[model samples]
Target: MSTVLAIAKRELKSYFATPIAAVFLVVFVVLCGVFTFQVGRLFDRGVADLAPFFNYLPWLFLILIPAVAMRLWAEERKSGTIELLMTLPVSPGEAVTGKWLAGTLFVALALVLTFPMWITVNILGDPDNGVILANYIAALALASVFLALGGCASAFTRNQVVALVLSVVGCFILLTAGMPLVLDAISGYVPTAIIDAVRSISALSHFTSIARGVLLVPDLVWVVSMVVFWLFATVAVISLKKAD
Candidate 1:
């Protein structure tokens, strides 16, 4: 546990050691505002709810989360520090978990900074705070899922660009799998069981379920299980790479 915390502290500090962390925070915050106000037309809608903000959360994260996660291991390997780190007493699983925790903490901080948006809606009218809370929970869970997936992709490559692209593409496919256009095309020939399974696996569906304020136990379990699976996959990939 101590070893994991050490690595997590190191990883979190590394983000601030350069301008990468600042740029990441600024870009996401700005984009959130733009998507919520301009693209979502919050002013035009005059609704007390934050539906517009949460509606665009998944699409925004598809890019930003990968950008944050791309360098977790790719830079370490590219700069040859991975070898030094692996030489330490720490285990690969611990290392993966630490980096994932650091990324998750950053997302928590980023979302906390967006609280003004919540406050704005509260001040304007009586909104369903319970639903808003659920949306935030869903957003955080979705971010962690993407971070873990991105971490797994990063473990397979030394190039940050490739890592970023792989993470984005992988996550995009998972998202598109739940879209009506994709599912409808598959429905023509695929069996109902397979289609149901695909929809069940897509993170987007679970996100919507939680965003509706229902807090389905299955949706929470699905996100958490996927996150754990990806982290384990990252550990496995690291172990195999070490062998090679």
Candidate 2:
């Protein structure tokens, strides 16, 4: 546990050591403002809640989160630093968990920086703070899923660009799986059970449910299970690579 925390702290500090942290924070905050105010037309809705902001989060994260995850292992492998990392006293699982923890915390910080949106909605009208809180929790969970997927993708290759593309494609599939359009397209061609399974596995469905303050046990379970599965895959991939 101490080793994991130490690695996590080291990784988190590495993020700030480069311009990556600043660039990501600036781009994310700016894009959130654009999507919420300009594209989403928050004023047009005349709503007190941050529905507009939350609605665009998955799409925003689809691109940005992968960018963050691409360097988790891909860069290390590309630079031949994975050899040095492997020589450490840490197990692959501990290393994977530590890196994932750092990435998740960094994304959480990005989410926290969006608190002004919550304040803005509050100033405008009597918004349900509870719903907003739930939405934030859902967003964090969704981000963790993306980060884990990205990390798993990163473990598959030595090239950061390949990792980024794989991560984005994987995230996109999961994001759209539960959408009405996707479901309708597959409904007749696919079996009902398969269709239902796809929808159930979609990150978007669970995110939307929690974003609406419907924080059920199933939704939480899905989030935890997805994160765990992807992280587990990441650890396995790293272990295989180490053996080879």
- TM-score, candidate 2, is 0.96
Question: Where in model 1 is the C-alpha error above 4 Å?
Answer: none
Clashes of 2: 0
- TM-score of each candidate? 0.96, 0.96
lDDT of 1 by residue, 41-90 (tens): 98789899999999999999999999989999998898888988999998
**Candidates' RMSD to native:** 1.3, 1.4
**Candidate 1 backbone overlaps, count:** 0
Per-candidate clashes, comma-separated:
0, 0
Cα lDDT tens digits for candidate 2, 99-170? 999999999999999989889988999999999999999999999999999999999999889999999999
Model 2 gets an lDDT of 0.93
Look at candidate 2 and tell me the lDDT of residue 171: 97
Clashing pairs in 1: none
10 residues in a row with least lDDT, candidate 1: 173-182
